[model samples]
Target chain A: SQTIHQWPATLVQPVGSPLSLECTVEGTSNPNLYWYRQAAGRGLQLLFYSVGIGQISSEVPQNLSASRPQDRQFILSSKKLLLSDSGFYLCAWTRQGGDGYTFGSGTRLTVV
Target chain B: QQQVKQSPQSLIVQKGGISIINCAYENTAFDYFPWYQQFPGKGPALLIAIRPDVSEKKEGRFTISFNKSAKQFSLHIMDSQPGDSATYFCAASPPNNNDMRFGAGTRLTVKP
Candidate 1:
C-alpha cells in the first residue's frame, strides 16, 4: 500500500517570510510526483511536477519552486511569500503509466 | 486557458436523489478521464475513472460516462447522501503524460 505524508497540517506565515512544505511517499519508488494549489472554494492549480530526482517542471511561473531531493521526498519552497501565496497546498503521486493518483493530506498556509 | 471545462459550479441535491456532474475537453489526445472528490481542508481523492475506449464504467454508486464523439464525460452518483457532499473535480490526461489537466471543480451539497 502506498501512502503520502504532508505537513504541517496548517501554517501561518508573515509576508516576505520563507516557506517550505515537504511531502514524502512510502511503498513506491520513482513515482511521478506533483504539487498543486487550491484557492478557497476554487479548483486545483498545477504548480510543479517531477519525473525523477532533480527534475522539476513548472506549470505556472510564480514565487514557488519545487525540488525532488530524494526518490520519494519532495519539497516546495519560496524565498519570500506574498499575501496571494496563501492557499491549500497539495502533494500527489502516481505510478508511471498509472491510472489513479494518491494525494497527501495537504497543507493550509495562511499568509499574514 | 483551462484544458478541461466543468459545469454547475455548485449543486444542491436531496438525499436519495441523483447527482450528476459534467465535463468536456477539447484535446482529442486525452484518453483517460477521471473524477476526484475533495472534502474541506483535505486533498482530493480519486473517485472514479473511465477510458475513451469504454463509453461507461461503474464502480459501486459512482459511474463515469465518456462520449468520445462529443469530447465529453460525466460522473453520476446514485442515491446521493450527505456524506457525498463535497467538491468534485474532473480531469483528463493524454497517454504517457503525467501532467493531467483538471477542471474548475463543482461543489456538490447533498442535503440529508
Candidate 2:
C-alpha cells in the first residue's frame, strides 16, 4: 500500500518568516509529485509539480517554490511568507500511467 | 483551456437524499476525470474517477458520469449520509501532461 506523509499538521508563523513543508511517499518510486494550495471555501491552485529529482514545474507565479531532492521526498519552501500565503498545502503523487493521485494529510499554514 | 469549472460553490442536502456535483472542462486532451473529497482539516482524497471512454462508472455509493461530447462530468452520491459532508473537487488529467487541472470545488453538507 502506498502512503504519503506531510509534516506539521498545523503551522502558525509571523509574516516574513521562512517556511518549509515536507512530503514524502512510501511504497512507490519515481512517482510524480505535486503541490497545491487551497484557500478557505475555494478550489485548489496548483503550485508546483515534479517528474523527477531536480525537475520542478511551477504552475503559478507566487511566493512559493518546490523541490524534489530525493526520489520520494518533496519540499515546499518560501524565503519570506506574506499574509496572503496562508492556506492549506497538500502534497500528492501519481505514477506515469496512474489514473488518480494519492494525497497526503496536508499542512494548514497560517501566516499571522 | 486548462481550467475545470465547477458549479454550486456550496450545497446542503438531507440525509438519505442524493448529492450531485458537476464539472466542465474545455480541454479535449484530458482523458481522466477524478473527484476528490476533503474534510475540514484533511487533505482531499480520490473519491471516484471515470475515463472518457466510459460514459459512466459506479463504485459503491459513488458514481461518475462522463459526457465526452459535452466535455462535462458529474459525481453522484446516493443515500447520502451526514458523514459524507465535505468539500468535493473535480480534476482533469491530460494525456502525457504532467499537471492536472482542478475545479473551484463544491462544499456539500448533508444534514441528518
Candidate 3:
C-alpha cells in the first residue's frame, strides 16, 4: 500500500519568517505530486505540482514554492511568509494513468 | 476561469436521510469526475469517482452520477451518518491531463 507522510503536522510561524513543509511518499515510484492550500471556509487552491524530479508546475502565483528534490520527496517552501499564507496545506500523489489521488495527513500552518 | 462549479456551500442533514451534492463542469474534454472528502484538519481523500462513459457508479453508501451531455456530475450519500460529516469537493480531469481542477467544496454535516 502507498502512504504519504507530511510534517510538521502543525506549524506556527511568525510573519515574515521562512517556511518549509515536507512530504514524502512510500511504496510508490515516479508518482505525480501536488501541493494544495485551503483557507478557512474556502475551496482548495492549487499551488504547485511536480511530474518528476526537478520538474515543478505552478498553478497560482503566490508566496509559496514547491520542489521535487527526490522521486518520492516533495517540499513546499517560502523565503518569507505572509499572514495570508496561513492555511491547511495538503500533499497528494497519484500513479501515472491513475483515476484519482491519495493524500497525506496535511500540515496546518498558522502564520501569525 | 473556474472549470468546475459545485453547489450548496453547506448542507445539514439528519441521520438516515439522503445527502446530495451537485457539481457542473464547463470542459467537455474532462473524462474523469471524482469526489473527495476532507475532515477538519486532514487532506481530502478520494471518495468516489465516475468516468464519462458511465452514467452512474456506486460504492457502498456513496454514488456518483455523471451526465456527459450536460458535463455535470453529482454525489449522493444514502443513510447518512454523523461520521459522514465533512467537506466534499468535486474534481474533473481530461484523459491525458495530469492536473485535475477542483470545485469549491461543500461542507456537509450529518446530525445524529
Which predicted model would earn the best DockQ? 1
Q: On residues B3-106, what C-alpha lDDT tens digit does candidate 3 reach at each position?
A: 99999999999999999999999988888898999988888999998888789999999999888888889999999999999999999988854779999999
lDDT (10s digit) by residue, model 1, range A1-112: 8899999999999999999999999999899999999999999899999999999999999999999999999999999999999999999999988877889999999999
Clashes of 2: 0
Q: For model 2, how does the per-residue alpha-carbon lDDT over A24-90 read when each residue is reduced to its tens digit?
A: 9999999999999988888888899999999999889989889999999999999999999999999
Q: How do the candidates rank by TM-score, highest first?
A: 1, 3, 2
The residue-level lDDT of candidate 2 at B66 comes to 90
**Candidate 2: regions farther than 4 A off:** none
lDDT of 3 by residue, A45-66 (tens): 8889988999999998988889
Residue A16 C-alpha lDDT in model 1 = 100
- What is candidate 3's TM-score against the reference? 0.97
Better candidate number, 1 or 2, judged by DockQ: 1
Could you give the CAPRI-style class of model 3?
Answer: medium
Q: Give per-residue CA lDDT, model 2, range B1-112, as digits (tens).
A: 3479998789899999999999999888899899999989999999988888889999999999999999899999999999999999999988864768889989999999
* Cα error, candidate 3, residue A68 (Å): 1.2
True contacts kept of each: 0.78, 0.78, 0.68
